[model samples]
Target: MTAARAAGAHADAVPDLVPDAAPSAAPDAVREPAPVTPEAVAAARHDLYTDGITACRGAFGAEWADRLREDIEAAFDEARRRPGGAVGRGPHRYYVEIHPEQMRGFAELADHPWVRGVCEAVLGPEYAIVELGFDIPFAGAVNQPWHRDFPSPELTRTERRLTSLAFNVTAVDTEEDMGPFEIAPGTQWEHGDGFEHGMFPPRGEFPRYESLAVRKYPCRGDISARSALTLHRGTTNHSATARPVLVLGVDAPGAGNDAHHDMAVTRAYRDALPERVRAHLHCPVVDELAPIVQKHTIEGLVMGDA
Candidate 1:
């Protein structure tokens, strides 16, 4: 069964992190009426708070997802050839941060009502789009250490508020062998000493994360949002085919995630974007888009282990 169809079969199995399937979206529904109900926004906020993640199945369509894969492949090829463009997550896994204009469906993905509603609810109305990227785990990619994308910010540690979010859209139907993403529900609240670079929790903490882990099988067109501080990792990929997923990062004002990324737009591309969409991108408007020179490399991940 397609992931969307399989969601129901597994919903009862994962009560806390089960995908909240939205209404079946038409081909153009992603771009239609943008207003979102307060109830939906409240539920999304609640899920993020309780589970540290949430998802909407079949947010777009298979065709739209295929287009995303095509764009990702093209960008990955170009990044592979440039020094520092593609950073290694493990032996066979890579992460590349690209400009929004690099992808054809970026605007659609960013402007979707679900995306907007979640951002508004969790990060506030002035949330900024700070990063656009993708992660690919090819054959031979090994299980990653349980870790957060970064150290929990002060707001999260002291005030118990999430300051940033990461939205992921798998470019293909994820299966058991493709190193499906795994996350430990509610681990975003855990923070203590012994974390390397304030990201990877020490191996002593692995057992708890493993016991609480839920392997996510998000199909093409499925989208999930999560606090970047959540404890999670990519499992080993035994399939020969690579699994690539788009990553869009948003931050509340003063989150400081923008300092880690170099997201830019050409003057013309910036001019063409809807004001509502453009308002979220806080980056330099350049005369010409320059090939990004990656500066924020995760040292712990570069060695394939912590």
Candidate 2:
């Protein structure tokens, strides 16, 4: 199937998280929505993410949104910021990095039952974060490249089962041309044995996968959640305005790449995970706060790196 389509082509009431072989509910009927069990949540996430693309546009609340925007700006003004912490790899876009406290601001935004429902349905309660990268509209462009996300299991011996969650919040209505995301659905299930990066190594490297239209969720706060190992990309933002978002790559307690080694702040975030979660993430865990990762794109006033 469609890999549990969320927020588009259908009414907002219908959850795309339902399986293709789902037995209950009439074609037109929205069933008595059931609570997602940890196992089912994991399975549905797997089913939904096998191709690796889902969107939860507008999932963050209004008040929460404004506050986060401010935090991002402030964080950007500071030093020690990594352009794209987790989700984004290179610069097809612009971004504002926020601190953990600012990230926590959106934590409560999950107060809405619908948001929590989606979280429960996809990640359940055992989830731990991999990294959070916030994006702001670049002065004149937008879009993502073709790529596949790897689960934590492949990167480290410690974490073999990783469930990743990501969200892209928009501040404006993304009309067809304003800015959209492009994706290949159901690629998460693809075996990576023979695949290679599309642009790397000079060896005909390419992310092996499919291309579907990026999911467009309704209103502010709608979100797309999924497991990792999905291939995806973003549509170039043709809009003169900006498309701001927070990209969180969360994995089942202990999934992370080794590249994060020795970063105090990143390690602190990793260390904060539950003991069990720590054991699952392959990255080093530290108790210290990370160095200031935010460096301003504007004025040269230096905010010393932590």
Candidate 3:
């Protein structure tokens, strides 16, 4: 796997790509419910702290993934119907942030033992769910500039403490021509000088990132988490299929990312959620679900490379 290979070259390589034991024989195999052990949490924490990423293969069954995909397609259709509903992320690529109620598996995803364990392990026990969204790159989507999701926090740049993390769940099995997500392990710690908006590195820095980059091919039911500060990009998609992946953002207290997102749920939905799940959500409980006006400030991605 890329994690193992990258770890060999970079001492800070991720060791927790397979958080549990080896992945099941089938990509869609339903995992029996089990408790997340201290050892698993410790390994996941180490991977996040060192390589800035970790993953668990086949975390959910294929049926669940299919349902999530159906929900995403419905949401995408709705978002595309309205102006400013889907934010452009370069040609043929769009990003949409949605309310928790928009997804049928919101609670199941948020309350999953592995997801909970990783958040608590890395961001401490008080981590908050701040964002729920998806990125869809269709055919003709151009390559994105190598960049971090956002600028590093002051604590991360100075005190070396990571305060936030992004978890991704792909809606379909990934193919190379579909524009696999690529990331440079350990570059999250690189506090470089020539970054546009403190997120995108200059073209001159591309070669360095390219040399270290590893393309990820996550299948349905797979989940990966990474520091949003890591240098990464979406390669050009040459296939006809659109690659849609769910993004869940979590933050440690004082991370301040919740300010940039408007993740909300209806009062009825909130009332139905378990207390543990409610504890992680920092967004508001409103009577209605409003379409989120995309507020992500990565303007460089609006026009991808030619």
| 10 residues in a row with least lDDT, candidate 3 | 14-23
- Residue-level lDDT for 112 in candidate 3: 86
**Which sections of candidate 2 miss by over 4 Å?**
1-60, 79-92, 95-97, 109-125, 137-139, 151-162, 197-211, 215-218, 257-291, 294-306
Rank ordering of all candidates by TM-score, starting from the highest: 3, 1, 2
Cα lDDT for residue 56, candidate 2: 36
RMSD of candidate 3 to the truth, in angstroms, is: 10.1
What is the overall TM-score of model 2 with all chains considered together? 0.56
Q: Give the TM-scores of the predictions, in the order they appear.
A: 0.87, 0.56, 0.88
Q: Report, for all candidates in order, the number of backbone clashes.
A: 0, 38, 0
Give the higher-TM-score candidate: 1 or 3.
Answer: 3
Q: Give the poorly placed runs of model 3, Cα more than 4 Å off.
A: 1-35
What is the Cα-based lDDT of residue 153 in candidate 1?
A: 83
lDDT (tens digit, per residue) of candidate 2 on 162-182: 345554554333455545555
Worst 10 residues of 1 by lDDT: 11-20
> Largest TM-score belongs to which candidate?
3
lDDT, each prediction: 0.81, 0.42, 0.81
